[model samples]
Target: MKAAWYGENGGPEVLHYGDIPDPEVGPKTVLVRVEWISIEGGDLLNRIHAAPSSDHHIPGYQAAGIVEAVGNEVTRFKAGDRVVAFDWNGSHAEFFAVPEHYAYPVPEGMDLRQASIVPIAFGTAHDALFEYGGLKAGEFVLVQGAAGGVGLSAVQLAARAGAQVIGTASGEARLDRIRPLGLEHGIDYRNEDIAARCREITGGKGVDLVLDLAGGKGKDLLVKALRPHGRYSVIGAAEGTLPSFDFFELIRKAMQVTGISFGRDMHTPRVHQLLEDLFADVASGALVLPIEREFRLSEVREAHEFVATQHPFGRVVMRP
Candidate 1:
C-alpha cells in the first residue's frame, strides 16, 4: 500500500508517500478501503508532535470508505458496506482499520467525499451546540471565525435549528459567503467591532449562545457580547493570544464557559445518534457539505499547507 508517513515532527514537507506494510486488523476492527479522507488541524498537530501520538503516525482522523474485511468480533458491518468513520487514524492511505462502533453507514445517495468531512467539524459543532450549549430555537447565536470548517458547520446547523446566527469573519468576501446562510448579521472583525455589533444585533440583549473558535481578546469580547446566563463554548484558538479574562464578568452574568475537546468520549451512542440525524438532514437535501477543495492522497503535504493558510470557506478532503 502507498501511505504518507512522517519519520519525525516537522512541516508538511516531511510527509512521505511510498510503499508501506499493510495494517493488521484487530478482533474488534474492520478493514476499510478508504475512498476519501478529511484533513484537520489535529492532523497538523500530530505531524508537529504537538499531539500525544507516536512519532511515525498516520495522521488522518475521519474517512469515508467501503469495508474490505471485518475482524472476528465485528458483526454489524460486512464486506462491501459503505461507511463513514471517526476518532481513528490511518485513513491517509488506501486502507485502514477501525473499531466497529466507530463506523456508521453512509446514507444512500450521499457523496463519499462529503461524508468524509462530517465527523470532525460537523460532529464537533453538533455536540457543542446541542449537547453542551443546549442551543434552543429562535435564540441569538454568535459564531466567531465563522468562515472556517467547524465554524461554517456550526453556522448551518444553528440556522437549521431556527436560531438567529451572527457570524464573524475577517473580510467582505468571507462575510458575503456567510450572509446567505440565513445569518441575521455578519460582523467583519477586520472593519467592524464584533462585541458591539453583536450587542446591536440582539437589541442590546447580547447573544444567547457564543461558539468561539478564535480565542484571544475575543474571549473577553465574547464575555461582553453574551447575554446574562448565556452559554459559551470554545473549541479552537486560530487567532491571537489566549489570555486570562476577567473572572468577575463571568460571575456577574452567571455565564457558563466551557472548553470542548472532540475526543472518543464525546462520540458516545447518543452522539452517534446525533450524527445519524445530521446524515438524515444531508440525505433529505436540508444540509450540505460545502467542500472548498479536494486533494489526492499523495498530496497530503499540500493539503496540510492549504488548511494551514486558512483561506478555504469550507472543508478540504483527500480523495484516495
Candidate 2:
C-alpha cells in the first residue's frame, strides 16, 4: 500500500511517500481502505518529537474509509462497511488497520470526510466542556486558541449548552469567524491581555472554565483568567510549548487542573454514545466543523507545513 512515512523523528521534511508492505490484520482488527485522513495535532507532534516504532513508520491518529476486510474475531464490522477508525499510528496510508473497538460507524447521510474528523476533535472538546469541566448554563467558559478544530468544537458546544463563551485567536478576522459559532466574546491573544479581558468579561470573577488548546507560556495568563476553584482543561499544545504548573500557582488560584486525553476514552461505551450524539448533531447542521484544506497523500509534507504555519481555521484533510 502507498503511504507517507518517516524513518526518523523530525519535521515534515522527514516524511516520505511511497509503496510499503500492507499491514497484517490481527485477530480483532479491521482493515480499511482509507478515503480521508484527518491531520490531527498529535500527528505532527509525533512526527517531530515521538520516537518511530520502526525504521520507516506511518504516523496519523484517525481516518474514515470503507472496511475492506475484518479479522476472524471481529464481529461488529465486515467488508463494505463505511467507518472511521482510530489508532496510535498508521492512518497516513492508503489502508489502515485498527482494533474493532477503535472503529466507529459513520452515521447515515454523513460525509466520509466529515466523519473522519469528528471523534477526536469533538470528543475532546465535549468531555472538556461538560464531563470534566462541569460547565453549566449561564456560566462563563473561556476557550483558548478557539479557531482550530478542537477550539471551534468547544466554542459551539459551550455556546449550545448556554455557557457564555469567550475565545482567543490571532486576528480579528479569525475571531470574527468564530463569534457566529457561539462565541460571545473574542480576544485577540496576539494583542489583548487574556487575563484582564476575562476578568472584565466575568465582572471580576473570571471565567469558570479554561480550555487550554495552545499550551505554552500563555498558561500563566490562562491561570490568571480563571476564577478561584475554576476548572482548567489541558487539551493540546499546538504551539509546541508545554507548560507546567507549580504548587504555588495551583494553590494561589485554588484552580482545578485536568489533562484531557480523548484517545484514552475512545474505546469506552460512554464515548461511543457521546460520538453518536455529536455525529447526529453534525449531520443535522446543529454543529459544524469547517475543513480548511485538502491535499493528496503524496503531499503529506506540505499538508503538515500548512497546518503548523497557517493556523487553519478547522482541519486539513489528506486523501489517498
Candidate 3:
C-alpha cells in the first residue's frame, strides 16, 4: 500500500509518501479501501506535536470508503459495505484498518466525499454543545474560530436548537460566509475585541457558553467573554499550544470548564446513534459542510501545508 508517513514530529516537510506493507486484519478489524480522507485539525496538530510510535506512522483519523475485507468477529460489516472509519492514526493511506467498533455505516446513496467529513466534526460539536456543555435553547453561545469544519458544524447545530450564535472569524468575508449557517453575530477577531463584542451582543450579560477551538494567547479573551458560571468547552487548539486555566480565574467566576475529546466516546452506542442522525441530515441537505479544496493522496504534504497556512473556510479533503 502507498501512504504518507513521518519518522519524527516536525512541520509538513517531515512527511514522505511511498509504498508500505498493508496492515494485517485483526479478528475485529474492518479494512477499508480509502476513497476520501478528511484533513482534520488534529491530523495537523499530531504531525507537529505528537511523537510517532513507529518509524512508518501514517497520521489521520477519519476516512470513508468501501470495506475491502472484514474480520471474522465483525458481525455488522462485510466486504463491499460502504462505511466511514476512525482510528487514532493510519487513515492517510490507501488501505485503512480500524476496529469494527470504530466504523460507522455510511447511508446508501450518500456521496463518499461528503460522508468522509461528517462523524468527527458533527459528533464533536453535538457532544460539546449539549451533552457536556449543557447548552440550552435561547441561551447565548460564542464559537471561536467559527469558519473551520467543527466551528461551522457548531454554528448550525446551535442555531437549529434556538441558541443565539456569536462566532469569531478573521474578516468580514469569512464571517459573511458563515452567517447563512445561523451566526447571529460575527466578530472580526483580526480587528474587533471578542469579549467586548460578546458583552454587547448579549446585552452586557456575556455569553452562556464558549467553545474554544483556537486555544493559544486568545484563550483569556474567551474566558472573559463568558457570563458568570458559564460553560466553556475546550475542543481544539489550532494555534498549536493549548491554553492553561488560571486558578484565580476559575475561582473568580465559578465557571465550568469541560475538555471535549469526541474520540473518547466515539466507539460507544451513543455516538453511533448521533452520527447516524447527523449523516442522514447531511445527506438530505439539511446540514452542510463546504469543502474548500480537494487534493490527491500523493499531495499530502501540500495539503497539510495549505491547511496550516490558509485557515480555510470549511473542511478540506484528499482522495486516494
**Highest lDDT model number:** 3
Model 1, 111: alpha-carbon shift in Å? 2.2
Candidate 3: worst 10 consecutive residues by lDDT?
44-53
User: Candidate 1 overall Cα lDDT vs. reference?
Assistant: 0.81
**Looking at candidate 2, what is the lDDT of residue 186?**
95
Per-residue alpha-carbon lDDT of model 1 for 8-46, expressed as tens digits? Answer: 777888888877888898999888899998887567656
**Model 2 residue 121 CA deviation in Å:** 0.8
The C-alpha RMSD in Å for every predicted model, in order, reads 2.3, 0.9, 0.7
What is the lDDT of every predicted structure here? 0.81, 0.94, 0.94
Q: Find the 10 residues in a row with the least total lDDT in model 2.
A: 41-50
Q: List runs of model 3 lying over 4 Å from the truth.
A: none
Q: In angstroms, what RMSD does candidate 3 have relative to the true structure? A: 0.7
Q: Is 1 or 3 the stronger prediction by lDDT?
A: 3
| Full-model lDDT, candidate 3 | 0.94
Model 3 — TM-score against the truth?
0.99
Count backbone overlaps in model 3. Answer: 0
Candidates arranged by TM-score, highest first: 3, 2, 1
- Model 1: residues >4 Å from true position, as ranges? 7-10, 45-49, 240-246, 265-267
